[model samples]
Target chain A: MSGFIICFLIGLGGSLVYLLRRKKSVKEISLFVTFSLLGFIVWLSIFLGYKVSPDRFFGWIIDSIGL
Target chain B: MENARISGWQFFLLSLNFIVGTAFFVRPGSIIAVSKQDGWIVPLIAGIFAVLIACLWLTLASRNPGLSIVQICTKVAGKYFGGFIALLYIWFFIQLAGWVTRNLGDFMKTILMPRTPISVFHLMFLIVVCYAVIKGVETIARTIEFLAPLVVLIVVVIYLFTLSEWKWERFEPMFQVSTWQLIKDSLPVIGFPYMEAVTLMMLVPYVKSRVKTGLLLGITVATLLISGIVFVTIGVLGVTRTSHFAYPLYIIVQELQIAEFIEHVESTIVIVWLIWIFIKLCISYHCAVTGICQLFRVSDRTWIAIPLVLFISGIAILTHENIVDNIAVDTRYIFQYTSLYGIVLPVLLLFLTWIRRFRKGESGGSA
Candidate 1:
């Protein structure tokens, strides 16, 4: 969890630096932050505590599609 | 940008090399595991599906002449939505690069270097791939065009030597599996090696002319080559034995014996396979870096190559517990994930683009 948190913070800071450096729009910054958080949360869920079984996730999709 | 443009043959070779990448060595075991003796049929069916998907992708790509898929997404959808989609593709490309890196590392550790850790191999591969990415796509394309023929020649020689051992009787009771089973198993083949040409969407803009025709031909040639490989594997090893081995093609090459001498040519085959894998890694890494540059409005992407290589190599090393887990994850879940991005996303994008264009045409006609 600590590792993920640090990685997320680093990414967030990097995004800000990029936005400033490129002179991008506020909307772009917001989009970046939103997507970064979204990705980080999912990644955290996968890597943080109990590992999510990729098989189960995929099996559910296969069953949902009736395949 | 003008200097970056590649000739049509270079474009064709790039696509061909990308399509017949690491998957050639890694896929046969899984395909045979599913389709049994009829595993060769999987590539045939997947080839047709790939051609159709390629045609649709080409149409969408040609509609926006100079833009890669990332730019096309931004144009078709508004900025935020397109940015989100483009990011997904960038992640996908980077992840694929990592996966291929890990695969090569695993193969080397298993077969050649038992004592060396896999990360060492990954780092070495990533360094070369980073160098290629920095050299730009034109260099990468020309590199593949110049070397692909020699690689093909080596593969042909390997095939000829192995032909003496092929048992036609081994293919007995073909298509024993039910139609549903065949189709279900074929999905992985389609989603993986075939639809993976979708990555070419990011490279199509670099081609000088007849972009659609170039893509179709490249894909066709790749599909044919893949089909030939699967067929040879099944014929030489038989379906059961082929599926039983971890690396069927590698094992088959190891088993090759010509007349009396000229045996144990597996090392030569490995060299050719490594070259193919290297080209594959470069294209994936290039696409990821280029996509990120376009996404972030970065004028020069080469400066970020080392950082990206570190991130990718770290992920590749840390992703799965081991090679067994890696293969399991790939065979079980990859098709589902790939379907979403490779098939569903492109189909939806094409449909939306068509509708938008039709409405504009209607409005103009009314005016």
Candidate 2:
């Protein structure tokens, strides 16, 4: 778990630094950070045992519709 | 955005590799399970259906030259509604990328390297895919153009090497399955690799010319090849075993013992499959990234690519509990879900575009 977090931070940080160095536009930077943070939250939830299966979610929706 | 262009031939190869991608390994078993000895015939029917679907997509693309499906959505539907439609497509593409990535991870874990965590495979493969996508479509096209022939040659050679095991009797119960049952079983096949080829609409504008011919021929050839592979697998492994194994093609290759020394060649063939999967992932990932850029009017695709890699990988891991769960969801829901994008959206856009064009024509005549 610790290893995953460290790797995630390094990857996220490194990418941010690279984008900043390139002087990307504000919108581009925000999009990157937004998606990256979303990814982090997802992975953290999965690792912390708050598993959310897309299959089940979709299946539930599909079932409700009676397909 | 970079004014990238791929030649007609390159587009053809890209289309072939993309459709054949993961389906090459995983689809046959499920297909055989449903259709039994008649499994080989499913791809033929599915191929014809796919060509018709491709026609819808091509006509849509032709109407709006040089515009991708995303741009076309916004153009035809107006801003807010079209933007919503485009957003749905972006989500679809990302979800597709996640599924493809998960397919790779699952295959690696189950067959090749059992000890390695599946996430490692997803991360590593997505990282490489991200790099290729960041390079733009032309690089990907050229790369697949070079690799496509090798994949074809290896697959054909594997087919030939297994010929000694072919049994004529395996096909004896041919055509016993009812037409309704056959069609029923074929829905998933159509929805998959065939209908899923709608993603190629994103690449249609990038092809230099003969987009229709290239797209159709690529799909036709892929269909025949998939049919042929299923045919050969049924012949070698027989209907019973073929339907049973998760990776029947791999099993057939593993059983090959040429001259008692030329054996266990599954590993080498896996390298070829990896190429197929890589090309497929690159195209989907590219389409997803490109869709986001065009939809949001973002300046740079490069920055978006890296972050998406993280999000897609998360979805890959979070999508299913395991292979069984994955297969269950696929058989049950994939057709209905994919049809919304593959069938419903393209048809809807095409209808609206025609209506708009007709109104313009009427106004011009009145003037």
Candidate 3:
């Protein structure tokens, strides 16, 4: 959660700066920030939380596919 | 951002260097672990398949000349949808950069500096790569062109020294793994260092001439060269021994003894492999920075490169608990991401372009 907040703040701050500059596709900066924050959240959950296992990730996929 | 353009050969060497990067350091052991004696064939098939996929990427680039893949995506799809796709690719490039950096740092820690922290190596590496990315892709390409021959020469010399030690009996008990198993083993080879050439889509537009054929030939030659390296690893170490070691290529290099006088040449080989890894990391960093710059309509990436490097370095350090988990994730899960970017996205882009009837313009089309 700390990782997610830090990354989210970073992304939000960066995108806000760009928004102030009124760059082309200024609206897209929000999208970029959202995605960046989401990516950080996922990485944190996997690497920091140790919640996801590679083997289990694949196994679940295989099971779903009935492979 | 920079308007620098490279010739076909330099571009070929750059692509070659990228394709044969840190992959050769570790892929052999994983493949051998799966296919046993038939590990040699995995690279052969993967290399050939990579050629076909690269040809697709080149065609897409040629059709939409002077535009990076991100730009091409925006042109083909609308701004919103295309920008979303481009952002995904940006993440892929950044993630790949992190992985390669971690691989290099881990390797140096294992072989050379057991006491030194891995973060020190990662920091040193990113500092150099940050300079390369800022100096622009042309500088990196020239370096690769100069270093490519030396890399090939060292590989050849190592292989020659180890040739006499190969035992034919090692190849016996072949075909032990089923065809399905062989196919499974080959997926990493295809999905990684090979199909990962799709990252070249970010580069193809910058080549001055012969974009399609040059990239195709480059990938083909690099793939073949890597296939030979895999074969040599299997021949010298055989399947079981190769699978046992983490750095199989380094072990193969350790076998080199010229008249028992010139020893410890494995250090030299490791240095050369580090150069290869450096070039790969630089290219990935360049892609990520350039993609971000393009995405935000930023005129220059100069300001953001350092922060981006820090972010990636953090990810590299924090992502894996250890090399064992790293390798497990790399071998098993990397295909899911690579297939999406390498195979699915490009095919979708090509299909969309055909449907929309987009054609290359007079000024920007291939020369």
The pairs that clash in candidate 3 are: none
* lDDT (Cα, tens digit) per residue for candidate 1, span B47-148: 788888887787788676788888888788769988888888887887778778888988999889989987789878898888989889988988898888
Q: Of the candidates numbered 2 and 3, which has the greater DockQ value?
A: 2
State the lDDT of candidate 3 residue by residue for A8-34, as single tens digits. Answer: 677668767866686635445544554
Q: What global local distance difference test value does model 2 have?
A: 0.88
* Model 2, residue B185: C-alpha shift (Å): 0.9
Give residue B146's error in model 3 in angstroms: 2.0
The CAPRI classification for model 1 reads as: incorrect
Candidate 1 TM-score to native: 0.85
Model 2 chain B weakest lDDT span, ten residues long: B178-187
Order of the predicted models by TM-score, top scorer first: 2, 1, 3
DockQ score for candidate 3: 0.12
lDDT, model 1, position B15: 81
Summarize candidate 3's per-residue lDDT along B79-150 as a digit string, tens digits: 999999998889888878887888888888987889998878887889889888888889989888888888
Q: Tell me which residue pairs clash in candidate 2.
A: none
TM-score of candidate 2 versus the correct structure, residues matched by position: 0.96
RMSD of each: 4.5, 1.6, 5.4
TM for chain B in all models? 0.95, 0.98, 0.94
lDDT of 2 by residue, B251-338 (tens): 9999998887898999878898899889989999999999989988896798889888888999999999888888888899888888
